[model samples]
Target: MILEVAVIFLAVLWVVTIAMFMGHTKRQRTLATQQVEADSLRDQRIRELARRLENYQGGTIRMGEELHELRATVAPLPDKITILEQRDPSTLSFAQAARLVTMGASVDELTQSCGLTQAEAQLMTKMHGNG
Candidate 1:
C-alpha cells in the first residue's frame, strides 16, 4: 500500500513539472514575438526619417543652384547702369539741374552750374521745385 502511494505521488509531481515547463516556454515565445514587433517599428521609423532627410537635401541643392543662376543673371547690371549713365551727358545734366532746383537753386544757378539753357533751366525748376 505504501509503495502504491509513493508511485502515485511521483506520477503527479512529474505531470505538474511538465505543465510548468510548457507554461514557461509559452511565455518566452510571447516575449520573443513582442521584441520582434518593437524592432520592426523602430526600423520603419528609421526608414521614414532617412527619406525625409534625403528630400530636404535635394531641396537644398536645388535652391543653391537657383541662387547661382540668379547671381549670374544680375552680375552685369552695375556695368550696364554705368554705361547708360556715361552714354547720356545731357541726361546727367538734366538730373543735376533737377536736384539743384529741388534744393532751392534758381534758374541762373541751374544754367551756370548744370550747363542748361535759360528756358530748360526754368522748365527744370518748375518741374522739380520742392513746393
Candidate 2:
C-alpha cells in the first residue's frame, strides 16, 4: 500500500538523522580533549625553557666575577713593588736589582733595589695569593 511505504520511509529517515547527530557529537568531544592536551604540553615546555635560561644567566655572572678577581690579584703588582734605587757606579748586577724591585720595597730604592735577588722577587707572588 502507498501508506505503508510512506510510514516506513519516514521511520528510516528519522533513525538516520539521530545516528548522524550522535556521531557528530562524539567527534566534537574528542577534538576538544585533544586541544586541551596540546595546550597543556605547550605551557609545560615554555616553563622548562625559562628555568634553563635563568640558570645560564646566573652561571655567566659568576664566571665574570671570578675572572675579574683573578686579574685584580695579579695585574697591578709591579707598580706596588717598585722602589727608587740610587744609580751607583758599583752596584749589584741588573738581575739582582730587578729582584729588589720585586719585593714590596723592602730595601729602599736609593741603596738596594736589587739586593733581594730574582728568587725573592718570584717569591713575592705569594704576598698576593690567588684568593
Candidate 3:
C-alpha cells in the first residue's frame, strides 16, 4: 500500500511539472510574438523617417541651386553702379536740370542748383516744363 501511494504521488508531481512547463512555453511564445510586432513597427517608422529626410535633402539641394542662380544674375549690378558712379557729374547735372525745368523751377534756380547755363535752362524748360 505504501508503494502504491508513492507511485500515485510521483505521477501527480510529474503531471504538475508538465503543466507548468507548457504554461511557461506558451507565455514565452506570446512574448516572442509581441517582440516581433514591435520590431516590425520600429522598422516601418525608420523607413518613413528616412523617406522624409531624403525629400528634405532634395529640396535643400534645389534651393541651393536657385540661390546660386540668383547670385549669378545679380552679380553685375554692383559693377554697373560703380561705372555709373565714375561717370561725369555734368551729365547728372543736366538730367537734374531737366527735372527741375519740368517742376517749374526758374532759369536762375536751375543754373544755381544744377549748374546749367541760362540758355540751357531755357531750352530744358521749353522741352519739359508743364507750362
Candidate 4:
C-alpha cells in the first residue's frame, strides 16, 4: 500500500514540474516579443528624423539656387531696352535685331519691326537654339 501511494505522489510531482516549466517558457517568449517591438519602434523613429532633416537641407539649397537664377535673368534687360528705344524708330536694322536676340530680347521688344509677336519670338528663339 505504501509503495502504491508513493508511486501516485511521484506521478503528481512530475506533472506539477512540467506545468511550472511550461508556464516559465511562455512568460519568457512574451518578454522577448515585447522587447523586439520596442526596438522596432525606436528604429522607425530614428529613420523618420533623418528623412526630415534631409528634406529641409534640400529645400534650402533649391531656394538659394532659384533666387540666384532670377537675379541673373532680370539684371541686363532694362539697359538693352533703353539702347534700342534711343535709336531711330523708322530705320531699325538687322544688326540691332540680332543684337537684341543675342541679349535674350523677345519679339515683344521688336513690336515696331514687322509686327513680330510672342509666338514669332518663341519660334525664332527655338530655331536659333536659344529657347
TM for every model, in the order presented, reads 0.52, 0.52, 0.66, 0.39
Clashing pairs in 3: none
lDDT (Cα, tens digit) per residue for candidate 4, span 48-128: 999999999999999999999998998999998998788667755655565667777666775556345667656666555
Model 1 poorest 10 in a row by lDDT: 84-93
User: For residue 100, what is the lDDT in candidate 3?
Assistant: 76
Best by TM-score: 3
Ranking by TM-score: 3, 1, 2, 4
lDDT (Cα, tens digit) per residue for candidate 2, span 4-75:
999999999999999999999999999999999999999999999999999999999999999999899978
Q: Rank the candidates by lDDT, best first.
A: 1, 3, 4, 2
lDDT over C-alpha atoms for residue 111 of model 3: 75
lDDT of 3 at 98: 79
Distance (Å) between predicted and true CA of 117, model 3? Answer: 24
| Highest-scoring model, lDDT | 1
**Residue 100 lDDT in candidate 4:** 66
lDDT (tens digit, per residue) of candidate 1 on 1-131: 99999999999999999999999999999999999999999999999999999999999999999999999999999999898677646544677778788889998887887777899988897799943
Clashing pairs in 2: 84-109, 85-109, 86-110, 96-114, 97-114
Task: List, in order, the clash count of every candidate structure.
Answer: 0, 5, 0, 0
Query: After superposition on all CA atoms, what RMSD does each candidate show versus the true structure?
Result: 7.0, 8.0, 7.3, 10.3
